[model samples]
Target: MADMSALTEAEAANRLMRLAKLIAHHNARYHAEDAPEISDAEYDALVRENSALEAAFPHLVRADSPNRQVGASVETSPLAKVAHEKRMMSLDNAFDDAEVEEFVARVRRYLALPADAPVAMTAEDKIDGLSLSIRYENRVLKQAATRGDGQVGEDVTANVRHIADIPQSLRDDAPDLFEVRGEVYMAKADFVALNARLMVAGQALAESKNEAFDPETVRQFANPRNAAAGSLRQKDAAVTASRPLRFLAHGWGAHSALPADTQMGVMQAIGRWGFPLSEHLRRFENAAELLAHYRGIEALRADMPYDIDGVVYKVDRLDWQERLGFVAKAPRWAIAHKFPAERAQTDLVAIDIQVGRTGKLTPVGRLTPVTVGGVVVSNVTLHNADEIARLGVRPGDRVVVQRAGDVIPQVVENLTREEPRNAFVFPDHCPACGSEAVREEGEVDVRCTGGLICPAQRFERLRHFVSRGALDIEGLGEKTIQEFLDLGWIDEPADIFRLSQHRDELVGRKGWQEKSVDGLLESIRAKTSPDAARLLFGLGIRHVGAVTARDLLKRHTTLPALRALAEDIIALRAATEPLPDEPPHRFQARIDKAIADHIGVENVGAAVGHALADFFHEPHNVQAWEDLLNEVSPPDYKVDVRESAVSGQTIVFTGKLETMSRDEAKAQAEALGAKAAGSVSAKTDLIVAGPGAGSKLKKAAELGIRVIDEAEWAEIVRGG
Candidate 1:
């Protein structure tokens, strides 16, 4: 420790306060935004500096100093108001192993226990995202909300309905009313995938620093935290459906139904109820064992799939927890030991631009493969144009990468000695398919014009087509699709139907045998006569996604009619182009609206309109449909469109959908005669918001739309 002989008490106090403010600001940006400008090392330095200053002037340290806090106050805009049955207090935090040990000692002292007090602790990765509450009634989901100031919160019933980890209808024997609390976060892989999709579609990037993440960026997502928070608040279920978000249950507030007398039992019971529980969590019987677990997790933090800033330790006994309740903004019964941020240096091999299925462009850094914990790290996702500009990173540059807890690897700094190229070019062509790419006005991503042809684009399109969102094809999954593609057993989606004829060939392939091939053929055959909406989506037309396909099929249910009308549709598109007497781009909105209007479902709006018009007007599209139709029989036509409180409702389900996967829910909605929309809107009748539902929910509630809980929604759908 540096000698502080020259520093006065006043000086030390002033420095400590300044350090507190700076560290708090950083934490807000990090925990709330999910975008960190400073390097992990730099952040660590700030925390260390703050700690040193506080240690020198303990009297000046505020009780609720940033150094001793678990999370910032919950965001308020989107969650609905509900007084917590038990206040969702924050946790006191510690920065290192020493601090964690000290925290344990303090707990022992407070309880007046022996030096070796057999106090147990459970160490869970402290997820760096928004906290949420999901309520269940009689083993069925009731209402879901966020923790806003530990009391009143904006209702995000729709958004909460999107996450797969959250059970839509609980199958547990716990209580009449159960309110499970967890962190609503975007998985690193999902975050990467989401960014990819947005880039492919030429959408905006989420905002980073609230101030820096501007609308001018292609998609305008606020960091993962903001994005996740925004997604959970949507009133229009469809909007929340667009984001890639997830929920990991950490603790709870109220569960008058549970007989279990401990938090561990509560978590285990819920896990048994089909809730997605964290696998890394553990129960410890002693403080020493808990510290060991914390250290072990800290060592493996770099390999975690989600961001974790710290580890939460709570009194396992529910009775004990109740006895040692709230102290100001935090709970006296629990504490969080924040692990120091760790960094590693790796060689940046190349910076490449990737075009996603939606046409949004993104930069990815290809790095020399290194093991951060147990996982191999060969690449790191670089968010957008502004991020690239800020990092000053280039191909062949040596860069510093940081991973906190088991979160995805992030490039913190570029530190190459050699002067490199000043900038990396954002590609103007689809790297996978050579299509002329363009960035939309006010957008940053340069997207590919070739929607279906690009390899990456094709894979994504195929995935979506067969996804729980589109045709809901079973057995034909990502691996199977890639395998079939490589073996030349299938090319276009139309080939899926033809696979039945080549069952012998499929069975003869490298890994497949008679049984597997037969099962695969059976699955394909089952979907051969898929519904008109499924057929429309499976065709892989640009702008004509699941909802648009369903909307169009509602008007023209047969393939021949859809094909016959293509020319006229193209002519209509020609009339709507911004250019004089020129045909609108195949993906133009006016044309989509014209089709929706002429076709019906006037509810079909701008985005779907553009998507459909583009798909229909493409010259090759008609032939593609003709070919697919000739091979496969469309499913028996059923226009089961239901007119409900949000009738003619168009909903999109993104991320892991609760109750059912996204595809099942969408198919079910269509089966009910409701138009399943791809994005949220003012006209949306109801949003079946599930867990991981993000910004769309916020927008919906902001519009004063009625958002219902999943259970109430099920009742409405069942005509209760």
Candidate 2:
């Protein structure tokens, strides 16, 4: 660790700020989606560093600090509907046996119980699957939901009914109102079979086309947990049923009455109620027994039918749990003991630069295939140019690769050899389109300037166009787009609208069914009058995300008007190039003035302004715009479209928004031309306070900010 004593105040403040951003990103990925990019252990380390930095620089704590946040609002899920009666909180973790002992001691200290007191705990395998809560009323399944942001969850009643392990009905003796919480998983054996089946299907299509199948085109799961998550979340119940999934009950949620006073008793009762219970739930007398059981589970984790990352130890006595309560997002009465990260040694054969849709170039290290944690990893990301310099990694070097706490494989260290070798040279141009690659000031990543022309950029852009946040065309996922590109049937976003013209050609193709093709055509047809903001976002404009697009379109309502403004910009630029109207220097000065006047949106500044102007001036981009405009007649949106309390007001939402998601709330605000600022300041006009309002709430009170409760906020939006 860096010497904390040696660091300057400014340096400490900067580190704390960086840590806040890093931790918040990982927290959202882990808590909200259950699809964490980094391992749980790695995430914990980041949090630790953030805490240490904050301890040193207490005054530098950000309003959006990681400590203040919980799981992100689950409102993004289409299935989200039912509000959880009791918050489905997560468990705190213990890194080692010493921490486990410390946890027990802390619990005793909190309760003021003596060391000699009989303290029993229940230790069970921590299944690495999505957490699900099934509500039972009158001994019948009422609803099933995923733990989305702990407050509200996605309703998956229809999908859960298909899982064999999830009981449809409970015994008559069960509580009148009860909620059973468990992990929904796919067995290792079934996961292998499913992947095998997918491989066969993929191969059959390739053979018919007389070409080799690319694994990239296949929507295979990265791990068993991911497979289970993706399977259970399918829009079609039949699709979920076809996939192998199982559920193992380990806990309870929102129960009307307890059958027993201990954790083991509840598990036994849940098993009797017809839901399959976890086999590893056992009562232990003290911390020694707890650690033994944990170690035993860690040893047998590889042989288990399903994936498990750790063991959970909860206070056996029901009264202790009530007394212990919660700390932050986790329960104080329980702690999860996770396995250490896994590592493997591999040879770095080659490093290739991949250009993403946004033009950011990522270095992918191709390695001699090696297995780490039973998964074969052939490639690892060196992250960027900075990572390359940090590690001094070169091709043909021996590297220590690990997936211990990361979803993506990473090369952590380079084992340099004694043999003489030249230093590696990074590329100066895009490998795909040969465009000049340049890194912006203060940015680590280098990007290609080639927009629509780069092959990689074209493929990714089209994929993003059909994504849920964009056009949201159903049945047109990445794999289908890849197949179309391979067959030379579609190349651009405009070509997507022209798909129906190839109905005859698509018929009887290897993987295309008449029903699927017709479904895709129907989806495309439905998007003819796509939302202006969504269409703009779908265009893959540089520096224009969904929110920025909405904000820009709110200012300049229609594509035609936006195009007109761009034309004026082009005219100004043209005037500088020996035009008859004015002197060159005077024309250049006019162009600068025109750009500054036209770009007046709240958050958009010079950088965004220039990106939009340059994008519109490009010939190919203009042609594509014209073609797409003809294909899908996007509607014109008024700047102050929604006449509501939120319109024309700078709003800041603090704490948990129970009514709608953060995304939904922000979208509603922007729909009315109100800018949603991240932090509250003197400029903030309104603050919507929800439950658990902390620093932001205190700040609002100090400033005498106009504050509205969630109920009041909901009522206003309802009227609009």
Q: Which model scores highest in TM-score?
A: 2
Q: What tens-digit string does per-residue lDDT give for candidate 1 at 60-83?
A: 554335555543434523334666
Q: At residue 305, what lDDT does model 2 achieve?
A: 91
TM-score of each: 0.44, 0.61
Instruction: State each model's CA lDDT, in order.
Output: 0.66, 0.78
TM-score of 1: 0.44
Looking at model 1, residue 72 earns an lDDT score of: 40
Query: Model 2: per-residue lDDT, tens digit, 1-720?
Result: 457776554445445544665676576676556566665556776776776776775655544456555566564566657789988887766678899999898778666678777689999998888889999998789999888767787788999999888888888778999999998998888888998888888888998999988877876666778788888877789989899999999888997888999999988999998888778888998999998998888889889998888899999999888767665467778988878777889899998888889788989888999877766678776768988888888899999887753265677788985446776677889999999999874356798988777889988999999988799998888889988988887877999999999997897898888987898899999999999989988888865666667877878999888778777666655664545867654554455445646765643433345557778988889899988988998888755454666677899988887755565567566656677888999889999888997999889888889999878877876677
Collision pairs in model 2: 39-405
